[model samples]
Target: MRLGNVSLPVLASAVLCLGALISPAHAVPSQPWYLAAFDHVMRVLVNNEAPAVQMASGSAEQQNNVDPAYYSRVTKEAGTITLRGNVPSDGDLKVLQGVAAAIAPGASVVDRTRINPGVPNRDVWLAAMTFALRQMGKLNTGSASLRNAAITIEGVTNADDDFAVIQKKVREEAPKGLNLQVALKPHDVRPFVWLAQLQQGAVHLSGHVPSEQDKVIFGHAQVLFQNLTINSSMEVAKGEPKGWIEATKVSLEMLSLLYSGSVAISDKVVKIDGIYSSPAMVDLLKVYSKRLPEGFTLETSILEPVARAPAARAEDMSFAAHQARASYNP
Candidate 1:
């Protein structure tokens, strides 16, 4: 049977049987374990001291007003790091904290209001932020799990805005399950990335800035995939010239068999070939035309997935299947 564009090989009977054998207990505080696994997966995908190096070319384009370089030393560095298994240490925490501070330096909490009284709203906001940061590669997931396991931020001031207040409340209620409603209105100068992974072990990623102009110029930019069988669709929403670029309507397609190791991803690689056009793209180009180097223009296309050795064990699969079970059972 096929779901979306990918095929499924497992029999319904066997799948149900395996499902039954796996108790909800298998779904307990595996957050730490999942974090470790996710960190390993990212290590394999983006190996380097600074995984954000890929942005250098774009940075140069924005600064020097030149045609952005398509590749960088960081890309090769990531390749080397992924091969060496030199995962970042807890010291990376300081590095990420510095990044967070840099992203929102001088930006105050402003105000805080309670959205959910039953749960620790502050903690939930923080958790969501942490999830966002981890998704952006600013924070090492493994390191975050370790730090958050015991540490708690207290007495943080609340914000006036809904998102800010929500984030503040979530942060205040830390070290607990996040069950709160909060909103976040990060100021300008925030750096981030959009990441999408599938149950079949495929991953799709892109980088963007908060500004609308930046999003228009870079949002419809290059997309990188880790495996091919899965298909992903991403939408880019550019905020004000200096606000956040949001990705919505993101989806992926893949065969369930890949998660069970019954089908090898390398053998079933599929290609996505298409073109995307948007008024935003044209407007962004016009706004940045003078800033761009001669012969430079905004374009969008699918990038070839980086090749890596397959996981050696079932535990190494990307979080799709595990997360799916957790989402349904949790």
Candidate 2:
């Protein structure tokens, strides 16, 4: 009969048996044929079919041979939610489907996940899965992913309230064992631009500030540049990036340390240029930049050293003194 499907363990055992009969001590070549055959087969199996072959071996130890983790992903778009990846058991798969259904009511829920019993932490994995679904459910169109122990949730939405819900979930409800990443952006596809310049004890703020954050940002500027006029030309608007407020606050803190400089924020990038007096200011900027929230980039160029006037020579000082005495006597 023709071979339909061959289990990796069975195939390995057959190879080992054949090797036993082939008596490697009597072989002429330096490398025995059976060892070579076994190695090649193992390499192919491990690379290509480790998961399925290991599961099919029907041994508890063999089932745990591969990675002791599960991969689960969920995506929501166009009124449909799709689930794909691996779960520990059929019960867990049903639980995931139930979560998807509960999160997106009236939306179609599709399950395409498999049951893999090698999951390391079932409770933590399920918590992560549910967290992802809840985050995605708040977005107009979004995707949530769980790979091993990392969970990523990304979405685009028009309402700030919806974004707030996602932020709240991440802050208060994230699972203990999994790493969570948020990449939520506004549905409005417009570039966000913010500019601030400090000159002669006055700071001019312009460009886009979130509607809800205008007062706080302006007040923060006033506090950072104490006793300086806060001239705001910024217009309140939406579509700011996830870390817009935090990044803006950090940028303003950096600008406050400058003698005369300007900071510009374009989309997710903050560009700072100006002059500073002390090297300590640069070190402080480096320290504050680290506090800028994730997903934002900082670029700085500040002038330094505070150009000094030249010293007068001794002869010139004596000549000036003599001239002053002559004028006074006259």
lDDT of 1 by residue, 1-330 (tens): 443453333333444465557667764455433444445444544465244643552454344532222110000111111101111223433343444445344422111111221222223334444443322232111112112123222211212122233444445644355332322333322122333333344433332223233334223322323334433232222222212222121111211112221111111121122211222333442343234333222222221222334453333443433443332211
Kindly report which residue stretches of model 2 are placed more than 4 angstroms away from their true locations once superposed: 1-69, 158-165, 189-330
Model 1 lDDT on a 0 to 1 scale: 0.29
- The Cα error of candidate 1 at residue 185, in Å, is 2.3
Q: Write model 2 residue lDDT over 1-330, tens digit each, in one string.
A: 112387767777787787778765766487678778677667655566655754574687745654555677899999899988878888888887898888889999988887776776667788888888887777888998888788888877644344444566665778776787877765453677888877656888877777568789899998888899999866655668998998999999998887666788888988877666477787888899899888898886565645453232323333533443333211
**Model 1 shows how many backbone clashes?**
22
TM-score of each: 0.17, 0.43
The lDDT per prediction is: 0.29, 0.74
Could you give me the TM-score of model 2 versus the true structure?
A: 0.43
